[model samples]
Target: MGNDGGSIPDRRDLVRTKAKAEQADKANQTRARWFFCALSKRRLEEPIVACPLGRLFNKDALLEFLLDRASYGADGAAVAGHIRSLKDVKELKLTANPATKGKGKGRGEGENEETPKFVCPLTFKEMNGAQPFAYLAPCGCVFSLSGLKSLSSAKEKEPGKEGSTTPEKDEEQLELCPQCGAKYSKSTDIIPLNPSPDDESLLRARMEAKRAAEPKKSKKRKAADPESSDPPKKKKSSPTAAPTVNPNIAATSRAVVTSLALEEAKRKAGMSDAVKSLYGDPSKPKQKETFTTMGTFTRYA
Candidate 1:
C-alpha cells in the first residue's frame, strides 16, 4: 500500500533529501572569492593583488602572510604558499563603481555592504562575482570578459585592417585596453581574475611557458653584452711593487694605486725601532708560495 500510494517516505529518500540540504551553497562561495582576501578572509581593500591562479588578496594581508607563514595557523601555507614574495602577484587596477560613489552608506544606513565597489569600465557591469572579469598584464586595467570581447570584435570588424588576414587568428590579435590606451597581447597579457579551476589550469600552463622562455632570453642577453661575456678577473696587487699597464683596468686607477703602495713601502722601510717592531722587515723577501701553503699567510724571511 505504501509503495503504490507513497503513504510513507522511505529512509533512503529521507537521507538523500538531508544530503542535498547539507550541500554547500556555491553562490556565496563565489561571492567570497571576489570580495574577500584569499589569505585573511577580510574584505578586500585597495592595493589588491591577484596570483597567477587568479585568487584575489589584499596586498597587506598577503605581505603579512609571506613574512611569517606560520602565524596564520596551519592553513596559512595552503592559502598563499604560492606567493613567495610580493613579485609573485600582480597589483590589480580596478575601476570604482559610479553607482555607489556618492551614496556611500555609513553605519545604520540600511545599505547592503555587499554592494560591489568596482565595475567594468567598458560595460558598466558590477564586478560582484557574477560576470567573468580579467585584467591586462601590461596595464593592470580590469574589465569584464563580455565588454572586452565585444570591443575586440568591433575593432577587428574594421575593413581591410592590418594583421586581420584571417579570422582564425583572433586569439593572437593585439588590443588596446579600453580604460587605458596600453596595448596588450590578447593571447598572453589578458589574465582572468578569480578564474574557475578549469581556466586556472590554462593560465598555469601559460605562466610556466613564459617562465621557461625567460632563461633562454637571459642567455641571449648575456651573449649580446660583450662585457658580461668574459668572467671577471681578480685584481692582484703586491705591497712593494707597481702594477704594469692592464688593458682590462683604467691606467689612472692603476697609477694611483701603485703610487700609494710605493709610498707606504718607503715609509715602512724608513720606520724607527719603535714603529718598525709591529711590521715585518721590508728588506727580506717572502718565501715562495708552496702547494701546501698557497693560501697560508706568510712572513718576511
Candidate 2:
C-alpha cells in the first residue's frame, strides 16, 4: 500500500512517544494540583493553605470544609478526611508578584493574562509551584531561594555603616525583611514553601518546636459568684409527724387480729406456771364493771 489514496498515516499516527505522554500526564497533574483548590475545585486564591500531603486549598474553602464536611459532597471526605481541623494545614503567606500587570495596566506587548497571582517579591519571579520559594516565619513575607541567597551574600559583604554593628552581629542576629521590616530568626524562620520530603520534615519539626515554646492555655475554669452558686437552705422537713393514720380504715382484718391474739396466748401458755403467775393470767382475772358517766345517768333518771 503506497502512500496513495489507500492510506496516508500522519506523523502522530506513526510516532507514539512514551516520554511525551508521561510529560503531558505530569503537566496535567501539576496544573490540577497547583491551579485549583483540592476541596472546592475552584481557582486557587491567596491566603492559601496546604495540607501535610501538600494539597493546596483556599483558606475560606478549607474553613468551610472543616466546618461542614458534607458541603462538598462525597469527594470532600475522600479529599479532606485527613484534615480534621485547621491545625492540619499550614497557611501560606504569599508575596505579591510585581511583574503581574493589573487590569488595563498592560494590554499591549508580552503581557501574559495567565500569570501567577503570587511571586517572589525579591526576585520579581513567578512562583507557579515550580520554583523554590520560602517565607519568613515572623513577618510571613515570601521570596525566591536564589533571590534570598543573593541578598544574604550582599548583606554579608556590605560594611556595617554604624560602628556598633558588626559582621558577626549580622550573622548571629535576626533577618529583617526588606519589604515589611519584620524580624525573623535567620536560622529557623526561613521555611521553604511546598518543600521536598526532607525539607518538609525539617519545617514540620521547626513548626512543632515554635509551637512548643508558646505559653500553654490555662485549663482551670473561673469560679462563679458565691451568692449565685450557693443554693437556698431548705427547711428541715419539720420532723414530719408519722403520717396520720385513718381511724375509719382498719389496719388489720378482725379475723386476722383474733388469730394474732390466739397465737400470742398460745405463746404465753407455754411459759412455766411460776413465771405465768408473776406475769399475770388475763383469762382468770375478774373485776366489777365501773362507769364514769355520772352526770348523764342522773339527768336521764
Question: Taking the tens digit of each residue's C-alpha lDDT, what string does model 2 give over 42-150?
Answer: 8788888876455678999989988998999889987777676887676776765665646437554334435666787777788776777776666657788888888
Worst lDDT window (10 residues) for model 2?
Answer: 215-224
Q: Kindly report the root-mean-square deviation of model 2 from the true structure over all alpha carbons.
A: 14.1
Cα lDDT listed for each candidate: 0.76, 0.67
TM-score (C-alpha) between model 2 and the true structure: 0.53
Clashing pairs in 1: none
Cα-based lDDT at residue 96, candidate 1: 93
Alpha-carbon deviation at 6 in model 2, angstroms = 18
Q: What lDDT, from 0 to 1, does candidate 2 have? A: 0.67
Tens digits of per-residue lDDT, candidate 1, 1-301, equal 3567766887988898887765545677887889888888988898998887778899898889988988677777877776668777889999898766767654344364667889999999999998999988887888999999998877788665564477656666667788878888987888898898889889888877876687458756876464454332222333222244453356777788999889768876776764454344454323322333323422331
Best by TM-score: 1
Provide backbone clash counts, one per model: 0, 0
